[model samples]
Structures are given as C-alpha cells and as structure tokens.
Target: MIEAFDLFSVEQVAFGTGRWEQLGGFARRLGSRSLLVTNAGDPGDGGLVDRTLRHLEQSGVAATCFRQRGEPRVEDVERAVAAAREQGCDLVVALGGGSAIDAGKAVAGLLTNGGSVLDYMEVIGQGRKLTRPATPWIAVPTTAGTGAEVTRNAVIGCPEKRFKASLRSELLLPRIALIDPSLAVGVPPHVTACSGMDALCQLIESFTSNRAQPLTDAWALHGIRLAARALPRAVAAGDDVEARTQMALAAVISGVALTNVGLGAVHGFAAPAGANYPIPHGAVCARLLPPVIEANVAALHAEDRDHPGLAKYAEIGRALTGTCDAASDAIEAGIGCLNDLVDQLQIPPLRQFGLTPEGFADLVSLARKASSMRYNPVTLSDAALTEILQKAW
Candidate 1:
C-alpha cells in the first residue's frame, strides 16, 4: 500500500577488500584535478590519505589537499571552496570521517551555484535549494560510522544557530562512494563503539521513522542485522577484517537508508548537543537511544493502546533481543544494547562535555528546534526532552 511515490537516484558503489585500488579510475573519470579533503593529521588516517592521493596520481589525476585540523568549520568550507575553485578541480573526494565528507558536500554544492554555504544550510540559513548537481564527489570512508558517503544530505553544525542541519538535495549525493573496509580497521575501541552506535541509530531510526519507504526499509533492516552482530566483534577486536567489512556495509546501508528515509529523536538532538558541547556526535546519540525508545513506546501506548506502531516496537524487540511478542521488550532491547555498549566502552555522559544540569535546559530548548525531531513518532516537549537527558545523564 505504501508504494505510491516512486523515487530514483544514482549512487556509484565500489566496495570490497582492496577496493581502494579503484579510487584512481573513478577520480580519473570524474576529472583530472581532485581535492582530497580530510581531518588534520589523524596520525592513523594521515598515511591512508597519502596513499589515496598516490592512487589518484597513479590514475593520472592531480590532487590538492584541504586538511580539516578540527571539526568541519565554516572557515574550512570556505577555504575548501576556494582551493577547489583555484585549482579548477572538477572532482571532490572526501577521505576520512563525516567531517571531511560533509565539507566535500558543501564544496561540491557551492562549486556550481556560487553562494555562501549558509544560504544552503537547512533551518539556519535561508534554506535555499541546491538546484545544480555538485561536481562529481567520491566518498571514501576511513571510519566505520556516520555513513556520510551514501547520504544525500551533508550535516553542518552552526554554532551561531546553536545547532546543525543538512545541505540536502539529490544533487549533493556522491557520484560514487568507495567503501573499503580495510581502511576502517585501525579505529580505536572508544571511537568504534561511538561510531558503531551512530550507524546503529541511523539504521534503527530509519526503519522506524515516519518517512520511511519500502526501499529505505530494506537498507535499514539489513543494516540493523549486520550492525547488531558485527559492532560488538569490531569493538572487541579492531583488526577483524570480516567484522570490519560487515560494519562498513552496515554504515553504508544505514547512510543510504537515512538519506532516503529520515531519522528519529536520537539524531534530532545530536547536532544541538554536539554544537553546544564538545561531546562526540555518536556519544550523544548512544546515550539518548534507550530513553528515547522508552519515551517513544510510552508515547505510543498513551496515544493508542492498539496502534500498529506498538507492534513495530515488538518487531524491533525480536530483531534486537530475540524476544517474542513483547512490544515493550523493544525498549528493553534498546536499553540492554546501550548499557552493554556503554559498559563495554564506558562512554561518558553530557556532563563530561561540560553540560551540567544548568546547561541542559538550554540544550533541550535548542534540541527541540532541530528539524530531525519532526520525524519522531511523538514530538517531545521541553520537559519530556529534559527527562530523556536526565535519564541518559
């Protein structure tokens, strides 16, 4: 009954062991000149970036690098745009985590239709549309989370707005996203848990979001199963290549699903929390997952004792915990997962990022405005949101 609206999009996928070898060919086809965007010298990631550039060189493409030393900042985007324009590079390749990928999305969007990045930023700016397709951008994920490579929207946090939003458009998708799990193997345990949760959240939220479509549901369910199995293995032992490959698949699947479907409460607050505090994005999401699920379940029950959504929660429960016919067990499954993950990795709460009880008031207010919340089954009030924060805290 839900297949009324037909959607079609393009995503060039190159994935496997040694898939990095294909980067040169994709870059050459995109353009001779390439902008390799990355975070500043993550000692672990720096060498990989160099090798990717060499691949481009071998492919007969010239590469100019724009290093993001910190998180992706407005100035970084500005400079990347300038570098790409100055070099006349027709292709943008993001090589690291979400920061570089988002920066590349911004650069590609602005490359064709020249304007301030703010103009295109959803909610914070004029919310202008990206009418033209950005230059051919290739996403190479070096991390196992965020799935920024497959998403059509780029999340940019704006401190001035006290939140973040996506630079969303069909045109913003990468021409090709290269998923080589070998590149994600060296991730530290803490980063792995956090990013893995982020991937997990994307899949779970996409599956449950009000905007989910059939195609998106396929990605979400597959991503959910793969992540649930592989994330723990990847965290327990980082060098497991098969686990990493499955995780890579999960992240990419979640990314594509979130790109096509949407997300729920956990992500609705991630940008606000990340913008206001130094807390990592995935950490914020990881902490919020259980309470948000409980809240959603409680809200659903309150709205209707017999809603289909309640049954969906039961479905999620069986998927996560293998529990039978227990709708509220989904909330339990979410809690068990979060607690097990946190204890395994011991992720810190918002307070570690300096969000005292006093700061949370403002954070809740800011989080309330984030557009991602619109997809949540129930729109949480200030008090309700604070309750979730307090529980996570």
Candidate 2:
C-alpha cells in the first residue's frame, strides 16, 4: 500500500532561456511598486540589475532597490521590511543568488504579518505561526543553485545568539518563480561548483530522508540525474548554456523535493557551522557531504541493512556513476564518486573555516538540536556525528 503524503510548492514557475524578459509583465500583475532585492556586488558587469530596473519601469511598475550583501539576518529582514513599508511597495522581486531571494522572502512575509523576524523564526525565536499571507513575491534567480525561488522558508541568522534558523511558513512560497538560465551563464567557476554541490547534496539527502514519499522521490531522482550529468560541465565551462539550463532545472527540482521531504545530516550541520564560522553554506555542504554519506551508510549497514534508504543510496550511486551493479557495489561507487567530485571542486575543509577538535563538541550539541537532523534516515549517535566531523576536517 502506498503511504499518504502532502506536497507544497510555488504557485507558478516560468523557466527557460529567455524567461527573464517576462519578469516585468509578471510583476505588473502582482502589484505596482516593488522592492527589488539583489546582491551587493554587480552581476553581468552591472548590466543585469540595470536591465531589470528598466524592465520593471517599462511595464509601469516602480521599483526601489535594496542590496543584500550576505546571508539574511534577522535585522536585515527587519530593515528590508521597513524599507518596503516606507516606500509603500506592495510587491517583492528577488533577483540574484539564494541569499538575496531568502532576504526578499522574509521581508515579504514580515510586511504582511506585522512583527519582527523573531516572532516567527524557529529555534532561536518564539516560533510563532504566521497568521496572514505574505505580500505578493516573485523570485528571479541569477544563479543556477539554491533553488530559493521555490522554497517556502527563509534561513535567517541571529548573530547575537550565534545561531541560524528559519522563518518558515507556507505563506512564504513565491507567487511566481521566474528562472532564466542565461542569467547564470557568466557565474564564476568557484561559485558554480559550490552551489552545484549544494544542490546535489540536497537531492541526495531528501531522496534518502526518513520522510521521503513517492512525489518527492520522483523529483529527487530526476534532479540527481540532471546534476550528475550537468554539474561538472557547468563548472568547467561558464558559458555553456545547455549545462546551465540543466543545472537550473535540477536546482528547482531539488528545492521542490526538499521542501516536501526535508533534508538530512549535511544540512543539519550547515545551520550550526554557518552560524558559528565564516564558511559559506554551499562550502559547508560540499565539505561534509561525503563523510555524512559514509556515516549514514555504515550506521544503516550495521543496524538496518534493509532500510529503504540503503537501496536509495544505491540508486543514487547508479545515477552518479551510470553503473548497473549490485546494491553494495553501487553504493560504494556513489560514495567514491562524491569524494572525487569534492577533490576536483577543491572545496575547502572545515578546519580551513576555523573548525577544530576544540569546537567539535559544541557543534555536535547544536547540530543535534537542528531541525534537519530529525529527517536523517537513521538516527545517529553523538559519537557518529563527531566522527563525521573529524573525517570531513
């Protein structure tokens, strides 16, 4: 018998090579004045942002620009919300990488909910529910990773508390996700590698998550296949439009899959690592993914060899290596493939990001409390978690 499951996703998705040109028309339908959230540094030599402003203006929608420098913080969301309110902006257009999109999502939620980020953020805050729908928001991704365009939660860090958490609600889903693969054609190779690895990790984790269901499985598997074929090409050649398009599609599929099934250990560690250290979110995932996979496979082998996740791991291996071998062989190949990818990408180790044995105990404690940990296929002991960290280091 099939199990019952629920799925959530963005209301609309406009994905293609030249879909960005439709942004102005989409915004016109949503609202008149827009809060345009983007990266602090110019993309496409400042032409992208300038063109976006022109598009909105041509479509008769006024815009006020807000540059997001890094990951979204509680204060940053508040400041953006204040700006939106002050400018009477009724629409939000997030255009850039994941950080900017997340910032825009949080601002849109707070604009209508009428409270500080702490009022609804999980773990580090009161964890209250949002009672109202967020303002109409559109996501225009310039990077082919993060898939923040379709996700329903915004990750916000609290520097004072030294933690990061999500301001989560179904209301935060974008009104439309407008993805134009051409926008990502000029992304730096290093950024492409990091983000592509992050997307791959999300797909693998979600596919093997304890909550995995048929719907999410379909999306995850397809995404994993696309990433397996496209990630290396995308990183090696920035101007390869076909590779960029494939990666972009894979990223959106990953976001949809993860939103429904949740993620596993790599993301579990990401929250604590990103909050306490200077590591980028993608870099953390890249550095830790292989070890976490090894740990989980070992735990499953020792205790629950028949776990569905084990077979899923073999499937992932097949996807990555294009091997039609037995389950055990396939799983090993998959793990080996990931290790090779990490070395090829040159993802920095945790130690390079200021992590050490001295702080392992603290990170383990915090990771245990992370929301993503609950979705790990097998419940791991603290010792196992520490070993994973040690291996990654």
Q: Using TM-score as the measure, which candidate wins?
A: 2
Give candidate 2 regions above 4 Å deviation: 40-45
Per-candidate local distance difference test: 0.81, 0.91
TM of each candidate vs. truth? 0.95, 0.98
> Least accurate stretch of 10 residues (summed lDDT) in model 2?
40-49
Query: Model 1: per-residue lDDT, tens digit, 289-343?
Result: 8788888877888888887667766666666655564566565675686567666
Tens digits of lDDT, candidate 2, 160-224: 98889998899999999999998998789999998999899999999999999998898788889
lDDT of candidate 1 at residue 114, scale 0 to 100: 88
lDDT measured at residue 282 in model 1 versus the true structure, 0 to 100: 83
Please give the distance, in angstroms, between residue 233's alpha carbon in candidate 2 and its true position after superposition: 0.6
Global lDDT of model 1: 0.81
